[model samples]
Target: MRAIRSLSQGARTSLRQVLWGLVLVLALPTILVAAAGLYSGYRAEQQATDLRMQETARALSLLLDREIEKSVLALQVLAHSSSLARGDFEEFYDRAKTSGLEEPSWIALFEPSGRVIFNTRVPYGVKLPNSNRMDALQRVQETRKPYVSDLYVGSLTGQRLITIDAPVIIDERVAYILSLAITPDVFQGIIRDQRIADGWNAAVLDRSRRLVARSRSPERFVGQLASPNVQEALASAQEGLLQSVTLDGIPVRTYFSQSPTYGWSFVISIPETELAKSAQRSLFWLTVLGAVILGGILLAVLLSRAISKPVDQLVAAAQTLGRGGEVSDRASTRVLEFDTIKRALVEAAAGIRHHEREREEVLAHMAESEARLRLALNAGHLGSWEYTPATGALTTTPTCRAHFGRGADEPVTYADLIAQIHPDDRALQKESVALALAGRTDLQAEYRVIWPDGSEHWIRVSGRMRSGPDGHPSMVGVSQDITERRLAEDRQALLLHELNHRVKNTLATVQSIASLTRRSGDNTDPAAWNAFMDRLHGMAKTHDLLTATQWQGALLEDVLKNELEPYQDGIRQRIRLRGPRINLQPGAVLALGLAVHELATNAVKYGSLSAAEGKVHVMWAVTSGSGQPALLVEWVESGGPPVNKPERQGFGSKLIQRGLAQQLGGEIKLDFAPAGVRCVITFPISTMASDQSGAAETQQRYAS
Candidate 1:
């Protein structure tokens, strides 16, 4: 076997070979058919040759009959002349010879008695023996009709001829018979004088089945039958006829026609083989063409197959490699670069399988690790948080359940966490988060959380943001319960405040005692001494209560009612306290306590609290300030004797102004009205705790 090249060539080669063999098989019949056709033509030509001769002979006979008609006319002209009465017959004879007639070999005139009266070449009054023997004349006289005779030898002229005759009447009765004869030589001139095609002949014949003219060989046989093959054709006088004939044993095809005037036939004939010769030549050329085409197809097939086989093999080998199936090692071929690519792909496919297996194992391990991490976070009550700064996904951990008061299985989100923040603290948390995201502040917020049960707790959440590789900050932080610790610290501070209050109160009591003792040694300044005791006594009363409350704080109304009770007829009924409940800080309690005591002391000496109708209506309460919950306390005294503004700022003024203003972060105002004295002190509510334990006791003692 030869080496194959490509698949396309192989297909083409195989197809061409098959096609070539088919062409040869098909051409075999065509060649045989052409040979048969040539042999059949030879036989047909032989038959045609005979038919042509018969047709030619019939055509000549028809021309001869027409000639006989013309002769009879010429003979009638001479025989009807009555020149034998007037003169000798030589005049008629001379006239007949000079008439310039063609084709007729003899002319004669017969008398009424059936004797030859005039002949073109006879002496006058010749008793022509053949005149009564002329079949043409005898027939015309007997029947009184012109007649055309068949080919016969004339008795007088002794020539083979066709005759024509007519009667010449002398006195309305049978008179004479005039006749002319046509020789075979006249028909020969007619046949030779006409033209015919190559391999064809022309002829004329009479109704007696004799050839009167022939253009070709056998001209000597005029007045004879055409041939044994076509004799029947002329005997029937059929015109427009074509038939095959044999002339001298040679076949021919003939065409014949009849002349109506004289009952003759004209014909033309040709050999059949000559007419069909081109068809045989064409068939031969077609056979040779079929052979050449078959050879070309065979050569094309072998060349095409050489190319197709290798291409088909290469395609199969490449497909095997692509599927990672086994193929020959030599499949790594030198055919083309693409074959090398197929081999490389096979190697890559194997490596890919190994990598794929390893990847699956790694993925499974990662999944396991994730599950464990999720379990630990849920168990530890730790909320896991991951902040992706890029996407802004802040995922909270499982521990955030406590913050949101949600079950572990319950779905929780950042919005739920934010909703749990106390409304008052919500803005601060929002601001902090916003600042952190904006890079202006760290993530730190202390805000109150409203638990699911409606109890509030303060949480301190602090985180340092971690920067990602892209330099954006992300927050991570923790929060825990700090509410109890904050409450404990508040309680401890309140106790310390009480201790400080008691110490300050003890010092004031000692100062008041010394002032009283010094005032007792001065009688020369009674007004001055009275004023001195009044101020000193106010200090002493304030300290006495401070020591009793352990200085947690005191109410303003309690401190006033207690010091003025000794001067009231109906203690509870005489004094009135009006204001919302207010708790004072330890320092405000001390200063306000001293200021009220001084005013009551002074009243017994010089103010309205000194008289019998000295009923003190004291009212203290909180009022609105610029900030919504700011505290204002008003001290109004009424139903007392007339009052005057003090002439000087004394120690009483100093205590209210200096001590309360400096320590309590508030202001004190003293007004001396005509009917009573009005004093007001206002401060912040934030300075006092919600539970006024110490202040409540002072109010109870004063109210009782």
Candidate 2:
């Protein structure tokens, strides 16, 4: 410690000695003034460089966003093209090749079952892999909607691409899937116009972290996971991020922006040295300025010392007088210039103190302003962030932390924010932010965030990117809780879906009832009419079962057993009934149950179940069909008075043949053999779905 103190003091003493010796000579003043001027000029130039760099980053982000949006638009156009939907492979292929569109681009169609109908990029007879459509086909077929898939390598073309799938619905059912593959070259072209400094690069990445295209290392880097910065940018998808990394052994600063249309991340990398080069120049000038200033002070001190030697002698005599040792009367007769020199020193000390006080006041005011600014930002729920396109350091505001469900005191950055966004939404959010940063659009999005607490919340964020003096973007935005709003909207959508379902069931019920009334015979035979009325009552009973359930659905077993209860007393011992545990749609349930009633009534009066020796058997089972499942049912009878085929079809025949067949999408077969009668019915599983309860009631009303 003593050595360090001694060295500092010694250095100070040496500096003073040197200054006292050099007077303000021509050489000292000239060098000092020139150095000071050079330093100021360097600072001005550095500021200009910063401004240019910031602009470049903003421009790059903008160009990337435009390219992505263009891709999305292209996909949409291709999806709606009638030729693409109609499987016009030859026309599509020819159009793609000759329409000035980029080559290797293709349009393809897939069936809801994942069968590829046609692909322009593939040979006319060649089959494309079914796996590519697996996920998309299921979602589109099941939900009947359009969806976008993440980037994948084309099994046919061997090129990395993203597929956009939209369902082709005909008669309210998905008929086919329209798909288009966007190649990486399209992304490459997007960044081609981006102006990157020498030794820098840019690229785009899909959600899987795969580099779809690159402006620099194009062919080599394709299919590789992007650098962490790119990953971060894709993850946030809403904000532009900057980071630094070593690429090909060269240290580079990278900026990442997102593409909303294509669900891609755009990354731009430049060398740190390029951005800091101006600062370095300024530093050099500052050094020179310091030297010159010191030199000027030294020169002035030396010149002053020479001129003040007489004043110093007079001060020495005054010190002697104060000590009671003064003798020379001439000491009081000091030169006028010497007296002026002493007065000037005293006034300069006072001025320096005054200046220090003023400087303190200015600093205090600045601190107060900063505090107020922070408070205002907090109140406004604004999150402020800064990214050095050259270094990748991202600093965010407290409000941003809260909005993202991070602790207010936790240190989070752009990369950290990106990591928190849901992967499905990250790419889109990043793209929007990039566009906003590029000044293409204002950044806005609703995204999901998984907080550290493991709870998820929806946030609606809106922000804008402003180009810094260095041309890089600084982002500022607000985030608010939209979780409740989104959930409510979802609930309303669900209720509407349920309502639509109920209305359809009701309509089917009305149709069945109308058909039954139309098929019933006119009131000419009193006995026949009386029997018809009894059948109608049975159908009415089924409708009651359905209406009680509000059309949600009903159990097939419950409806069937209820309709056959009256016949159980006399024929319970003579009957055997078997069927799967299943639910039924209202239309099918009512139709099937009432049709059963008609056959039972006919049997009790004239068929096998009519005699003491008669026996009746009923059975049902589920089986697979071309699409979902098929249900097969049989009713058999034996030991009746006599078995005979009906010469003419009656209401019973029509109900069993037409109503059951049409309503259940099933076949009804009746056989009159020497031993007894047998009836078989086969139908699709949809008929047995829980919503067909009203069908039974429809059939019952036919007797009325």
Candidate 3:
């Protein structure tokens, strides 16, 4: 032992160095591990950033596509103007002005030669420069379809604008080109409204790679070509992510999508630093770990222990943040790096809270919008539904459920929905759904549905098929109850048919009246013709009364008042007309009208109405005769020249006797009383009473 102790201290120092070397070798992997961790973290951040950018780009692309589609739809509507088709330029300009007044962009109509015929922004006589490249217009004219043009400077306003052109085809020839000019301000607003991340920029490019709109510094970059790298990337793919430098020499990670409607590209470029921030933090921590490794072994152990506790605390805080929990200030570990991580966790928590609040607000707005939609549907008697063909699942709004006579909470399958349809309409509904799902055509059908209560309702359904997230077929549609409208149309058709029939019957009656008058030699003299005309006037007054009653029936009092109106004008007090408010059937009204006409004519000529001192009393009563109800009408005249029986029955008298007896199924007696003339007419009331009751029932049923 003494001899070993005699060895140099250098040997002991060398053994210690070897042990330290082994420890250094083992610690070298820690640096490598930290580097690998930093790289992995950077890759993850890049992936996340890419996903966000792609989503933003897609959303912007969809919004721009919708705007273009709206412009096209508006142009198509304007193309159908009747004035444009009729070659009325002045009228067409007026209509276009009215239509464009509320639009965000201006509208113009151009001749086939690219000459402005009408412009909403300028007067009719104002001349404007023609486009050097009229590819959009020419394409629309050739294809007879809508076309969206590349960005250009407006000739009138000198502002950057894009045009959507639709051809107005008449008689299989292009007649006019309707164009709508939209400014970049519209797309600028859309980009701003999207709430993109700070330090992130978005831009829109036309098919030619020219900048149509830029979310940042629009005035400087708009109308300029995009960066060469961006153009090359977009040219190769419809949508993708890539790293490119902006025109201002700022490197960015970009996501771009090409629009299907306009061939435009939407780009969302996030600054590279945003993605590098996480990697920088990781590298900084790795450097700190390497520095700790360079310290003495005991110091390294102490430093690791010190760093480990704070790191554990930071990890717990991060986990809490990931779970959407609030981070407390007590999470601070008093270590600079760890404290920074804690602060970042707290900020992340705050960001999550903010995002949650926004989500809640969005949900509330969606609820309000849904409520408004329901109210509108109820007001219009409309219902909406969605059906998934794969699952046979049907989702219906409350209004739609009610239309099918289903409870609010009832689960409805596609088959259940089909079952509610009327048997005659079920096949049609099935065929329409099949066609829609097959992408053959849109679904549109007017059909009847039978409710559980045994009542049928006519409903019009219109919808289109769409692909779900998984590419499965689904249908979204609206239904409207058109029962009342259908019934009204039916009533109108019946009225028209009745009008035609009544006109034919009236014409035949007029011929009969003329023939009867001529056979009686009434046309041989002027006085006779005048008397015949007066008789015809009486018939005309009765016809007016019947028409006013919708040909359903006329009141007995109304018939008498019409026939006696002329005679009673001068002798109001002398004429006494009284009767109960009895409704007569149309047939009864016509027969009674003729009989009253004859009676009035005779009275005006030779009876009480013919003299100043003459008086007439007309009355009717409902009385029981032979156990059946009967209407008894008596027309008596007094205070006139003494009445005498005619030698031969004239047409007037014969009409009252024969027509009243045959047409009214009644009895009539005319007595030549010395006091005056008295006529008694008796008819059974069964027909009129039954007819009145039936009409009342029909009206009540319809009302119910």
Residue clash pairs of candidate 3: none
Candidate closer to the true structure by lDDT (higher is better), 1 or 2: 2
TM-score of each: 0.33, 0.38, 0.43
**How close to the true structure is residue 537 of candidate 1, measured as C-alpha lDDT?**
68
Model 2 regions lying over 4 Å from their true place: 1-104, 108-183, 205-212, 217-249, 253-267, 275-282, 288-704
* Position 172, candidate 3: lDDT: 75
Candidate with the larger lDDT of 2 and 3? 3
Tell me the deviation in Å of residue 339 in model 2.
Answer: 23
CA lDDT, every model vs. true structure = 0.64, 0.67, 0.78
Q: Give candidates' CA RMSD values in order.
A: 65.0, 16.3, 24.7
Q: Write the per-residue lDDT of candidate 1 for residues 125-206, one digit (tens) a residue.
A: 6665645455455567788867777777766556677666777665455566666655767766776676666577666666
Which candidate leads the pack in lDDT? Answer: 3
Residue-pair clashes per candidate, as listed?
43, 40, 0
lDDT by residue (tens digit), candidate 3, 212-246: 88888899999999999999998899999888999
